[model samples]
Target: MNKKEYLEKLESELGQMSYKDVKDIMDDIGEHFDEGVAHGKTEEDIAAGLGSPEELAKSFREGGTVASVLQKKQAPVQNARQKDTTASAIFVILFNLFVAIPLWIAIVCAIFTVGAIEIGLIAGLVGLVLAIPGFGNFLAAGICLAITIALAVVFVAVLIILVTKYFVIGTGKYISWNKKIWKEGL
Candidate 1:
């Protein structure tokens, strides 16, 4: 089939995609077909070289357009809950780094330097209350703080693993596998 005929067939089969998307994909297939034809291949040879129409449609549906793929290595996954959870985890991590750790240090310093355990306890309690959700209408802020702390911790651990993996021989292979799985939507 010619490029236009192949595209029309693709459009009919994949009804949900936009015309522009189909056209762009067809253009890519046409380029490959043209290359094969230049090399003395028949139309049937060109079509087979491009692979099955169903497989091509599946790639477009899951991977998005070539333009979008070039813009970002991996398409964003389509799970709303997953996105929310990732956001929450990241928030918890930041909270731990900036708020929780500093407050804990201050409390410890107060107890040792000034010999004022009561003062330290009071400050620590205040900090804990502020950190806890539903202690006031600041429940949302508390929730955010918790999430930030959690995500920060996870980020740190991942960073450490990445660094160590790259430096170590066998560990680097595992690191490469982790990245591949992440990219492939596993």
Candidate 2:
């Protein structure tokens, strides 16, 4: 059979399919013929090598239906969504690296410094109690100073615990958000 006969046969066999499918199939087959002719092969030889149009139509119907064509059509959209996801991932990573990480470290160091201050206050209170006897006429003043230091310790301890707890919760939520973006995309 010649190229025209083979394509006409294929088109007739695929008549039940959608217009887009039929057109795409015809275009592909036409290109095959063109390529074969360019390669110095005769139309009859190319049609023989391609097998019967009925068999080609049957294979297309069995395995390459609307689903395959739809997937091809959706490929660009899927690629665009993937690009969006990639951008989100890059933003999250960069933000974590440049802004979030440094800020987190600074807050943690501040917490530690506050903790050290609390320890120092406790030590001062202990020292006041130990030096009370040596204060002599100023023993009342020493007691008042010890009470102030003790109060400061309590205040700092409560502040640090609350801050640390909230910081941890905030960190967990941020990490979860990052995971969600990674898994589900933008």
Candidate 3:
């Protein structure tokens, strides 16, 4: 194939990709052609070196998602679902399958710890409420319960923050997988 036909085929094969990606690939190929011509390389020789457009296109498509990592601008993550319920359900099912066990364990541990603290707080609160007048001091109990409640709130908040951070990471991975699966199926 001639250089023009080769580049056109490459561009057409890559038409479904983002314009920037296609443009970038074309630019690189254009550079290669120019450099080869400058160095007394024939169109046939350059085309041979580049291989068939279909094969080159297949390589590009099969390659890792380069555009996913490279960008001068980051798009805001839109939470609105453009896909139907089945795909959404599948994503959820896969998500749970991948992370449910460890996620549940962490949550259960946090809940149990919080439950223990709540039990202690309730006991102290009950003691404060039921204390006989002039028999003993309720001041210590109230203060302790207040402090424990505050601490428990902070502890639960920390757990939530940690869990949320990891969940977002897992979600990003799931989205990537879903995109790959969709592309492959197409």
Candidate 4:
């Protein structure tokens, strides 16, 4: 049989093996076929030299060289990938405790302060309008000054609100990223 046919039959014979095991076997066999072809051997000859797929699968099941090699290759790779996530978890916890929480509290205080200032401005404007008769001469100048200052405060409050919104969104995204790293590794 050709390389493809041989591999298909071998894969069928390896049905009881784990996916990784079967894949390793197939890859090794395919490489042998490639090397044999490079040395001017036919696929039939190579497949014959490798022996029947059933016997090969039996050898693999019986802890053959391929099985041993697969075990050796997987052991080191699994260990290498098995990272300790304790550091990342600790960093996130410490940062939230020492930095993020304080920043969030400060942002909340700023928001409340801005809201109060806006309300005070509105009340002052209402009071000024009500006491218009008493301010006769200075009323126009006072009104203009109050309006300008109110506009400035309103602008500042709006900016703070926008900044707080983005800060919250960015913090949420950062927390989500940390959570992903905790689960999946960095």
Cα lDDT of model 3 by residue, 38-146, tens digit: 9999987999998888888888876865666554234432222334444666765666678865676686687667667766766665675565343457667666666
lDDT of 2 by residue, 1-186 (tens): 999999999999985899999999999999999999999999999999998999999988787576888998999998988888898899889989999999999999999999999988898889889999999999999989988888899999999999999999999998999988876676
Which structure among the candidates has the greatest TM-score? 2
What's the candidate order when arranged by decreasing TM-score? 2, 4, 3, 1
TM-score against truth, every candidate: 0.31, 0.61, 0.34, 0.58
| Order of candidate numbers by lDDT, starting with the best | 2, 4, 3, 1
**Candidate 2 lDDT score relative to the true structure:** 0.92
Residue 173's lDDT within candidate 3 is 86
**Candidate 1 to truth, TM:** 0.31
Error of 4 at 147 (Å): 1.9
Error of 3 at 1 (Å): 1.8
lDDT value, residue 58 of candidate 2: 90
Count clashes in each candidate, considering only residues at least 3 apart in sequence or on different chains: 13, 0, 0, 0
Query: Cα RMSD (Å) per model?
Result: 23.7, 11.2, 17.0, 11.3
Q: Which stretches of candidate 4 lie over 4 Å from their true place?
A: 1-63, 76-83
The worst-scoring run of ten residues by lDDT in candidate 1 lies at 110-119
The TM-score, computed over Cα atoms with residue i paired to residue i, of candidate 2 is 0.61
Q: Which ranges in model 2 have alpha carbons more than 4 Å from their true place?
A: 1-73
Predicted model with the maximum lDDT: 2
Better of 3 and 4 by lDDT: 4
TM-score-superior candidate, 1 or 3: 3
